[model samples]
Target chain A: MEKNQILSVAISGLLALGLAGTANAADNKPEMEKCFGIAKAGMNDCSGSKSSHSCAGQASKNNDPMDFVAVPKGTCNKIANGSLTDGGGVVKKAM
Target chain B: MPASKYTFPCVAGIGLRAPHYREVLETLPELGWVEVHSENFFGGGAPLHTLRKVREHYPVSLHGVGMGLASATPLDEKHLSDLSQLCNDIQPVAVSEHLCWNAATGFVINDLLPFPYTREALDHVTRRVTQVQEKLKRQLLVENLSSYISFSQSEMTEGDFLAELTQRSGCGILFDVENLYVNVRNLGVDAEAFIKTIPADAVKEYHLAGFSERDGCLVDTHNHPVYNEVWDLYEHVLKHLGPRPTLIEWDTDIPALPELLNEAAKAQLIIEQCHD
Candidate 1:
């Protein structure tokens, strides 16, 4: 093959591999949903709700409907007898 | 209900926190068992995966910090279910919660708070404990609280309250020696009297943690090493209650794995001496 053609083919192969890698990365991202009103004080996943404390086990109040933890994407609302807030729960708020 | 299949060894364990998870799992240190804050593993994924791995090498005890057993909010069912699921998953050697309230009418304080030791409160706590025991289908060890405040309407000492709760609810006691010391220092509780009041067999586990003094009040911070005074108190407890599964808990400002193991070694020495 011509040198330029060979170079173009190699670049195209690398570009295709890069795109496939990106798609695989996207596929690897686990589907997660935010479970709210279940975290005990100071036990929330992160500082998504309160202002006073910015770390785990630092929630200012218990069952702060605003504080949440990430669960499997669709399992939050399906938790039997689980408590959650509006807007499809805190996951959307967090996003 | 059948008793929990798991039994903790009468040796020294450590509170398994995040910072030490990797090293503890990798090195498999010479420890009795490890306890994790149940809430930390409630959501699943990496935390639960690590716990599963840790479970393979160690007998894990699910120490819950968020059950709010004394809360007046009718016990969060989801919370109980989540804990039940965790219990089924981990099958820990023991499960325990504090003898304090964290939620009340309309608000929940994340910190453990002292409640009035009234007959009404007793009834409330007993029912809640029974409910928890029913859900877990195993005896729950209730730990005494280290409080900074006391209610004016308290009708009984914390020790008496715990003893009665055990008798009425069929639960076990997780005697936290440091918490007793903190109460003695901050609330003027008589440590010896507290020890004498509790029934010995009821104490299935013991927690030894460090405390700090803030404005002359002792705080169960679990940051520093177990203090001399607390160790002295633990010796007294060992004499009365005999050796139990003692755990060295360090939550905040967590030290390296060796430092925690060293603390655990000290507890192991004390426990062995008691056994001898």
Candidate 2:
């Protein structure tokens, strides 16, 4: 019921929600958003394909390669070869 | 909180990254101090939890990667508040951020980008620095950033800008030697002139990191070992600026803890020589 404590709680909630909003604002940026969307779609299209490298490689060329923060080439190779599969599900391949 | 509890050893330190965190905590290796990216610990999770444990053994410095001080955009109150909260929680020995911008008019680069060092830019940056210091209620050590490009409109050099900011805002300096070296080679910035301009007394800490060559420019990657040339420059700085709490920062392609400690040990040797 203290004024300062109430103010602190309100501020904390704002910051927590602000982070998600910031991320959304970041997504609204044209090049970054377009690249990420193309890359995500490319990932989905080639999600479980054993030859995901060809798709990923093409997608990476068309999409924003910098979006994923340096994906190991080995992981991409594994995804392409189907060795990186999960149990009865596929982790979408992205760089 | 007794400030002495987080007393920084007047020697060299290294950046504490995830790869080397466990070994550092488990072994409790002899390090003068350690710096971590402030943004990483903004959210209360495993990373922030780990920082609390690390703080117990080593004198921790929170180095921020974001909070674009020189950006034309309005200051991010949320980011500053988060940083302030973290500082309160950890009670770090030192807190630092770079003199670069990430956000602009409706655009966020997410990487540190250089702007024209014009008078307008200087005014913008100085105001932001004051706001940050006032919000934190602590003297922030602003680190110089490395840039790949330069603007023709630049009036004052980055060093001079920092000097003026320090004079105006009463903030301390966290001079990154690698960034200065990178600027010298890439932007044809006069490193010696930079050293001359900055107020030596304002400098509270030094950062030594590695730069990688990219397209005829040195990038502040901090992924490789400290270069021989940068070490020489650090010695030059130590000689003129006098010994300050130094740190070895390696962010990308981070090696083992011993390797980082080895780098810090190299800096320590220089610090010792400076003292003698």
In terms of DockQ, which candidate is strongest?
1
Interface C-alpha root-mean-square deviation, candidates in order: 9.2, 14.5
- Window of ten residues with lowest summed lDDT in model 1 chain B: B1-10
Instruction: Please name the candidate that would achieve the greatest lDDT relative to the true structure.
Output: 1
Native contact fraction (fnat) of model 1: 0.00
Reference-based lDDT, residue B183, model 2? 83
Clashing pairs in 2: A50-A80
Give a tens-digit lDDT track for model 1, residues B10-85.
8888987765665676677777888888887786776677788788888899988778877878898998999999
Please give the distance, in angstroms, between residue B267's alpha carbon in candidate 1 and its true position after superposition. 0.6
- Per-residue lDDT of B218 in model 2: 73
Residue-level lDDT for B178 in candidate 1: 88
The TM-score that candidate 2 achieves is 0.75
lDDT of 2 by residue, B1-276 (tens): 123547766788778766566566667787767888888778675567778888887779988878998887899999999999999999999888878888978998676777887878878888988899889898888988788888888888888889988998888999988888888888888989999998999999998877677547576777789899999999998888899989887766667777888888888888888888
Q: After superposition, how far is residue B7 of candidate 2 from its true place, in Å?
A: 3.0
The list of candidate 2 runs beyond 4 A from truth reads A1-95, B1-3
